[model samples]
Target: MKRSVLKFGGSSVSDFSKIKDLADYLKSRINKNEQLIVVVSAMGKTTDDLLTSVSHLTANPNDKDLAMLLNTGEQQTISFLSLALNDLDVRTKPLTGYQAGIETRGHHLKSKISSIESDFLENLFESNDLLIVAGFQGFNEVGELTTLGRGGSDTTAVALAAALNCTCEIYTDVTGVFSTDPRIYSNAKRWEMISFEEMMEMSALGAGVLETRSVELANNHNIPIYLGKTLSDEKGTWIVPNDQMLERKAVTGVALDKEMAHVTITYPLDSKTFLTDLFYKLEGAEINIDMISQIQNQEGLQLSFTVKESEEKDLNYLFDVLRESYTNLYVKIETTYCKLSVIGAGMRDMTGVASKIFKTLLTSDIPFYQVTTSEISVSYVVDENYGEKAARLLCEAFDL
Candidate 1:
């Protein structure tokens, strides 16, 4: 029997009515005899609400307890969706990560899925049942419960798709990944197909379609990805493996991440020592760094990195730590910084693509304060003042 993994985000399964509607859609497919593995995220705002509760209730919420608390969001979702499916006369079972046989490498909040055993799932599929599993959280070999950090649902869907060797159907509020965040970029359109590498870069640069880690796992496993809207029939984009013959556009899409925050560190003493110390502090704060750069010309190691703006408080805490050891390790914070990325597979061999992108900026010419790149992505930073304008120009230039 053919099987497909469908992942619905919080917005898609936000309410009881939405769950009922999703159940109806699943019944149609379930009746068709397609073995369906439905991965569901916490209902809309549940995770956020959980966070708010933790902050107010406990000064230092234990990780074990916090995991227990945060996981309720998804628990509520999958079980309810399962019941709704059952009401439709479709056989269904709601399984938590531990119950679903997802084994992971004990990383707690950011666990890596080690493997998924299908012995338990075989009977479920044999019975023509719908397996609705909790997204994001998993259990390790020793039975330690772990969650997939931030966009856990996306990661959960991708991981299950790879393990099941099935097509991943990602159902979200948006019809698929867009050329840009439609809310921000008025001209932002959708792509019919995008490569895994390009999608990875997009996710890193704040592409909303799929998480970078999830895209990576899917790519490595040769799982085909489909993005779609939950309430509509509009076809979402397909993220294909790099091994395939990808039909590339001059530019697949342009994306901007407002969450970007910039940190500049200048060392007045030994740079290497200070560099090591600074990274230690960032690690302790659990801040993820991106687009890092270092410059040396007697300016004492000047280093800059981008992180999420939500880390503003965390970065402030980090600065306090740096202020302790290095008296002259001057730091500058820029809250109005954002990253703009142009993605494409054709860009690999295309000369002047970067220049064309930088040149098109002439009309708006948002001064390039910083730059970064990967084989599939070319990114730059701009004052938040001009961030959207830059995104729109790149979108128009790429004809997205």
Candidate 2:
């Protein structure tokens, strides 16, 4: 039988009414000859609510315990969804991440999938027309429950699709991928189709339509993903291989990442050892550095890099450790900054894209703190106040 995987986000299964509506959608998609797997996230803000409740119990709970608590959210969805589908006379079964044969590696709350048993899943489909698998979770070697980080449900869905050799569809709140976030830019154009490469870049740059890891997995495995709104009939966006892209705009989209903080360290010019040690320590701590710059001055060589705001707690402790070794080290952190980026595959051979970006911002008097570029992307770090204007002006300049 031809099989397919469909992933619904938290918003899609937020309540009983939504789950009932989803049951109808699944029945419409199911046929006697084809088997299907449906993956789902925790209903609405259940996961977040669980976390908030945890904070009230204890500021720092054990990671294992946290995973155990959070996994229940998805578990509830599967049980409720399974019941709804059964009420509709659809043969369905609810499976946890482990029961579905997903094995994971890495620590709790941020696990990476190690492997999946395809035969087990194939066997389950023999009798049941549809299997409702919980998303964003898996079991480790020690048999402890672990959750994938934010947007892990998307990753879970894509991984399952790759393993089963089936097409993957993601249903979310948005109708399609826009040239920019519609919430920020109301006039942003919606894309019918986007290249995998472009979509991956945008996802990483904070497009939020799809998780970056999910895009990477889909691109690597030659899987195409369809993203659309739940309970809507509008045609959504398709993320396919580059060769399949229909709109080849030079500037595909403008993306903004607000959860960013810039860290600048002024170290002595002769302190090469200090610079090396800092990076080595960051690597060991699993800190991701983005948009780095270095400049030599009469006093010292100043180093600057951006990291997710969530890392501030780790960085603070690391700085305390470093001060013991280098007493003269000077550091500054700006939490009031946002990273803005422009991405497109067409920019690979295009000239003057960077110049146009700088000119546009310069003319608008939006001063950027740091700038970085890739084959198909250019990023700027600007004050939070200027982020919206920068995106709007750049979108207009590129005619995105």
Candidate 3:
């Protein structure tokens, strides 16, 4: 039997009315004979609210306990959504991550899906018209519940689609993928279709519409993903195979990452040991470093890199550990910075793309701290205050 994986974000099923609307929409779309899997996130800020409630109990909670607490939000959503469907006489079965066969590994608060035993899910499909699964939470080998990190519901949906060998549709608040975040650049253009390679780049570089790991999964499985607004019949963006992307643009879109922090470490000159040790420590800590710029000075070697602001705590601890070695070391942290990037597959053969980005920043008087380039994208770290302006300027410069 053919099946489709449909995922709804938090905002899509925030309230009873929204859940009812979703049930009605599903009723209209599902063929009586076909199988359907629906993955849903916690309604609205329920997850955040849960976290806040936990925070009131303890500032430093155990990772395992935190996961146990956070998983409840998604469970509530799945159960409520399933009840709504059942009310419509749509034979629906709601399952938590573990019951649905989602197996995950790694730390509790942030875990990677190891594999999914789909036999249980297949069995459920035989008896139900719809299988509703909780997103973002799974169980480990030891049977402890774990929740995937932020935007994990997307990962859950895509992984299920891949496992089930079906097409995936992600329903969010946005109508479709756009040239840039419309909230930042009001004139951002919507895309009808985007290549997986381009979409992967955009997602990795801070396009919040889809999770990076989810895109990687979709690309690896050659699964097509459709993203659109809920409660609407409008056509949305399709993330398809590269061969399906016949019309390529020089610049596909602009992405802004506002949650970036800039860190600089200056150590004694002529000390390659310090450089090696610091890098190894960062690697050991599993910190994702981006846009690194190193300068060798007469007095010292200065290293600057960009990382997610959430890692400030880890970075600070590492800095403290290193301070013991380099007594005179200097460290600086800038939290009010963001990365603005332009990505497209056409950039592989395009010229003057970097120049255009630079020209836009210069004309707008937006001073950039650092710049990095890849085959398909150019990213610049700039003041957060200039983030939107820089995106708009680059959007116009590249004609996105």
Q: How close is candidate 2 to the true structure, as a TM-score?
A: 0.94
The prediction achieving the highest lDDT against the true structure is 2
Please give the CA lDDT of all the candidate structures.
0.82, 0.90, 0.89
Model 3 sits at a Cα RMSD from the real structure of 1.8
TM-score against native, each model: 0.92, 0.94, 0.95
The weakest ten consecutive residues by lDDT in model 2 span 27-36
**Candidate numbers, best lDDT first, in rank order:** 2, 3, 1
Q: Return the TM-score for candidate 3, rounded to 2 decimals.
A: 0.95
All candidates: CA RMSD (Å):
2.3, 1.9, 1.8
For model 2, name the residue pairs that clash: none
List, residue by residue over 1-400, the lDDT tens digit for candidate 3.
6689999999998998999999988876665566789999999999889889987899878888989989999999998988888888898999899998899987787788989877777788777999899999999999999998889999999999988889999999999999999998888899999999999989888889999889899999999999999978788999999999988899999999998889988777576888888889987776788899988878778889999887888899898998898888889999999998899899888788888878778987999878888889889888899998888888888777
Q: Could you give candidate 2's per-residue lDDT for residues 137-157 as a string of tens digits?
A: 999999999988889999999
Please list the residue runs of candidate 3 whose C-alpha ends up more than 4 Å from where it truly belongs after superposition: 269-277, 324-329
Off by over 4 Å in 1: 140-142, 280-287, 311-324
Model 1 per-residue lDDT at 143: 80
